[model samples]
Target chain A: MRYIATILLFALKYIALKLAFVPLAVILWLCWITAANYRKLSLAKSDVELDKIDQMLAGIKDKLPMDAKIGFRTNIDPGRRGVLYFKSTLILAPRILENNDRDTILLIEDPHLQPVLDKNYECLERGGNQELNYCLMRRRN
Target chain B: MLFFAMLACVLVLFAGTSLSLTKTCGLSGPLRFPVAFALVLVILSYGYYLGLLFQIQIGILLLSLGLPPILYLAFEKYKSRQLNLSFPKKIGSKNLAVLLAILVLTIRFNKYVYRWGDWDAWAIWNLHAKFLFYPEHWRNIFTASLAETHPDYPLMLPSLIALFWRGLGFVTPLVPVAIAHLVLLAIPVTVYLALKRAMHSFAALLSLLIFCVDTTFIHIGGSQYADTLVAFFVLMTFVLYQETKVSSNRRLVFVLGIVAGSTSWIKNEGMLFFLVFSFSFLCFHFKKPAVIFRYILGALIPFIIVIHFKLKLAPANDLIHGGREKDLLSLISDPNRYWLIIKHFTMTGITDYWIMLLLVMIVLINKMPVIRTLPFMAISLVLVGYILVYLTTPHDLDWHLGASVDRLFHHIYPAAVYLFLLKFSENREIRLWS
Candidate 1:
């Protein structure tokens, strides 16, 4: 009777030890699934906006001159332009992007800002949401 | 034609002149490939510094650097020395399939999610590389206009990226993107290789799976920050140190030095790592002054480049410049500051390294020893250094913690996992060097 009790206790301990890893494995699986999904889901909203900006910048890559120091100006919230600035800098390389919009030969600014460009200086802006949103622009001067 | 040339140049850069030396130093098997790739990044950055000094053209500079390696591959030596180094067969087909699947999915998801990579990827690291691509305007990278992007940071990661861009004669976003993906892949694979080499197959796979599944690891590594590079060097340096400890060859300590010194060349936090690593290594082998001298001798090249960059080219770091405004004593004295760091670290630990931590506990219960591994001391010291930085930082504690704490953990995680598995190894009397 004593021997049987000892064997039973040992088996129970061994089984419980193995059982502990079962929850951990499950937890890890769930964590991976949730974290991956959560990040993907959370990013789902901004991904579209980023893709639109990417498309806008990429479309104008050839139009920008090499070695030109360009500036990006957008009426799209003072807060949001940081992303636009970074993206524009990357998409258009060797063409420097100064944070300032003044005193640059080329600028990639909002299409709605024609009044600002027209009233402020001698410059041209063309292109948009499709062809000429003017995410790409070069002034030949 | 230049693209093919660039590919050949890259092959030479990673697997070039030092193959015979590395193999002799006991870095055999597939492990040597990733390790060699990392060492190449360090050497490439240092070589770039020399090229810039000499006003060498990028194309000419790369071609000349490739000469030795190209010769090495062409000559009888490389073929004669080539041992069979196929990927680990012990991983088995099914495990290999899972591993490949995980790598592919993580990379694809990262691409879908972080197309341009996380913020610092473009704004800083790749931005620095772009400047280097325009060799004439590369000095403009250090101008005061780009102060916020940390021009003071070391050039290892950026220099590696620029080598490809400069080779191709154009900077594409794909260059940084591709390099980042490779580094991200290398981290888990390094963990797997290290453990598998130790004959702990189960622990090895577990580490790989956890790393692959952990979105934090993927998100940050794929983000193209210098932290990913720093993480790799941190693990690499520890591995080199362990190899130096176990091997009969005293010369391996020199390679360990180069690897440790390369840490500082990766990022500013890496400087802190170099200091801690040196201090920890010194504590372990205090009696062996010859080994220490050999280590510092090996460290000379990368360390000199780092010093020259800091003094000549790079601007003052913002943290040091900003700290003058803050009341440092009060921040240090405050209990809440301590609490904030603890809280953030704990949360990250629970989420990130808890599995490794659990296995560490199991090992402790089963066959506990009083002596901690050298990594234990090094990791603790580095963590303490990070917390100290947090206390003194001029930025809002909450904001700074939110932005940086996860990455700080990520940098330490691979090394920690490696250490945990080393501790968990079946060999009870593992002589981990001091």
Candidate 2:
């Protein structure tokens, strides 16, 4: 009986110790993965373009009389033409022009306001010219 | 130099208190010095806190300059307390040998503090102290409002550290770390005394040695963590509870309740210990229900004060929130996470080894003739209940449960050591070794 008890105790302890090793392994794996993929995504344009983007955001903020929240999403894709994408939201929509490219159209959603696009030549010409892309919108509701 | 100064002040205040308490009790002889010393230390701790309040430089200096003497007094008081209790004057050679072994193991592996992971100490515990030191940045510690990281850990340890920093003229992160070590060292001493009461001195010493050298225990003790403090209070409550049981001193039981409550104040998991003790006391002392109830109330008073301060008074951002919603099953079933926690806990060095020894001693004692089956059974039941608690904790099976298990082990260590000693000393041969 004593021998059996000793054996059982040892087995239980051994299993306990062996079972405790998993979390450490997982933690180490996480640390390694995070370290490998950690890099700051730098926007690939001159300060002027970056400043222009900030100015655009600021201008949109000023033009919208109502308080419209703005947020930005950035992703890295090696093959994409534009390295950076800026999205802006306004309170209301401006008038649309006929030459708008539906493919790159920044969709504006407002229950109260109709969709409008800048078809003047400068806005369209600037859209495909740079490695940076701007999508503008106004929330109507 | 600042650390030494603070130590000195604490010692002096401790000594003064010890002197006063001994004088009041009219207790004299070889025990006087030690008793006086312990009283002084306890007294001086409060005194130092008072100095911090008034911004008295002299008071601060005195408290800081007096800590060593206070510690010396406490050591003396422990010895004196043993002598008064009719304990053997000298420990037997076998027990001494074990003590030496533990001392050697501890000293040799003391460097593990620098080697072992102290991520929690660095990130949470010390970070709280940093914020407390510069209260202007208190907002940074309340929530991720100032930073993305969570700030919801219990504040007892950090608050104590803050108090020490404010009381002293300087700051060193090591102050709180040192206090943790001090509490760790005190656990064996307290356990030794409690065990001596129920068993032979030699058995008590052997148990102390085993606990001192336990790998996990030593690692936790040395770390800037609250586990050791929690363990100390848990042991204190158990010791006092046992004392009340044997002597029927309701006051001792009341005191035990306060200590039990303080355990909860130290950490959230302390509530588990508090509940276990309350249940144990209620069941054991059911015939005297009113006495038990009063003791429970005494314990709850201090606990409530601490809880009120933490939840209501402390900044809202620092309050741990997401705990209200948790999943229990994941903590037990997740093998990968659970094992990682067990490994770290077991590898805490010599302290873990001691816990293993304690487990063996408990088993051996169960076979002994002198131990009464009832109390032993009761303690075992409580311990099993604690383990079940670990199993049912609403934490992720892998990581959270594992981490909590480590903390829970610490909470019960003192009681475990005391019970092991009590059981081992049942043998006549072991008793004579003292």
Q: Evaluated with TM-score, which candidate comes out highest?
A: 1
Model 1 bad stretches (over 4 Å)? A1-73, A91-96, A105-120, A124-127, A130-141, B73-113, B323-326, B359-367, B370-372, B426-434
TM-score, chain B only, every model? 0.90, 0.67
What is the fnat of model 1 with respect to the true interface contacts? 0.17
Using Cα atoms, each model's DockQ against the true complex is: 0.10, 0.02
Clashing pairs in 1: A127-A132, A127-A133, A127-A134, A128-A132, A128-A133, B284-B434
In each prediction, how many residue pairs overlap at the backbone (N, C-alpha, C within less than 3 A)? Answer: 6, 51
lDDT of 2 by residue, B137-183 (tens): 33334432222222444555665676577556544444664466456
The prediction achieving the highest lDDT against the true structure is 1
Per-residue error (Å), model 1, residue B242: 1.4
TM-score of 2: 0.55
lDDT of 2 at B215: 65
lDDT to native, each model: 0.71, 0.49
